[model samples]
Target: MSNIDIRHAHSLPPEQARQAVQDVADKLADRFGMVTGWSGNTLNFSRSGVDGHINVAPSELHVTAKLGFLLSTMKGPIEAEIRRVLDERFT
Candidate 1:
């Protein structure tokens, strides 16, 4: 019943970053049972008892991922997945 928020900074344009987020979301949608959709510069989804949101602005990619699970439970894997997705998109 608690939440954790994360913010990321990117060097890409908002539109591009939003697309990247959408791509990641698309890959994660059905399997994870999250509604992966884009609205403006934001991508939002929730699944596996967690809420995942990403916002893209010019030069920034902000992420807010939260789960009712303990931090120790979801932190590492989620962070790693985000890193992998970003690397695939932006690098």
Candidate 2:
């Protein structure tokens, strides 16, 4: 398994940050068939080959994921897409 951990700083309020995370989750669910739910300030997501959570705070969002063998090989693109989404939504 491969792990990805990313922390992005943002200036949005807590609710807006959570909404941004939710939007990102919705997009991932639509594009990648991911299942997602919120637990407190954390948005958890999973699929066959990936599992992750995004933790939302007033000033930061932390994303962490574990990739299964097959997906591990594509980690670069996966992480890049995640960063792109975060950049678009939070920056």
Candidate 3:
């Protein structure tokens, strides 16, 4: 398995940051065919070959995902897309 862990800091307040993360999570779930569940401020999501969590906090969002071997080689593009979306949304 391969792992992707990224945490980005933001200046948005807790509520706004939470909403932003939730929106991103929803979009990701739709695009990736992920199933998600939430536990307080954290969203847990998974698909056939991936498992991850998005942790929302007052000043940051942390995303961590593990990919199965077949998908691991595409990690670069996956990470880039994630970074692009995060930058567009939070920066």
Candidate 4:
């Protein structure tokens, strides 16, 4: 398995940051058939070959994911896409 962990800092308020995370989750669900839900301030998501959670705080977001064997090979692109989205939404 391959793991991706990213920490991004943002200035948005807690609620706004959470909303952005939810928006991102929605996009992921639509694009990748991911199932997502909220557990307090954390957003959990999973699909056939991936599982992950985004922990939302007032000033930072932590994204951690584990990619299964098949998906591990594409980790670079997947991580890049994630970073791209985070930059787009949080930076």
Q: List the residue pairs that clash in candidate 4.
A: none
Clashes of 3: 0
Candidate 3: tens digits of C-alpha lDDT, residues 1-91: 8999999888898788878877887887788888988899898988988999988877788999999998899999999998898899887
Candidate 2 achieves a global lDDT of 0.93
Among these predictions, the greatest lDDT belongs to 4
lDDT of each: 0.71, 0.93, 0.88, 0.96
Model 3 lDDT-worst window of ten: 17-26
Clashes of each: 1, 0, 0, 0
Worst 10 residues of 2 by lDDT: 16-25
Q: Alpha carbon lDDT of residue 46, candidate 4?
A: 99
What are the per-residue Cα lDDT tens digits for candidate 4 across 1-91? 9999999999999999999999999999999999999999999999999999999998899999999999999999999999999999998
Which candidate do you rate higher for lDDT, 2 or 3? 2
Candidate 2: how large is its RMSD?
A: 0.7
Considering summed lDDT, which 10 consecutive residues are worst modelled in model 4? 82-91
- Candidate 4 ranges with C-alpha deviation above 4 Å: none
Question: What's the candidate order when arranged by decreasing TM-score?
Answer: 4, 2, 3, 1
Q: Candidate 1 residues 7-27, lDDT tens each?
A: 656777666776677777777
Clashing pairs in 3: none
Q: What is the lDDT of residue 67 in candidate 1?
A: 74
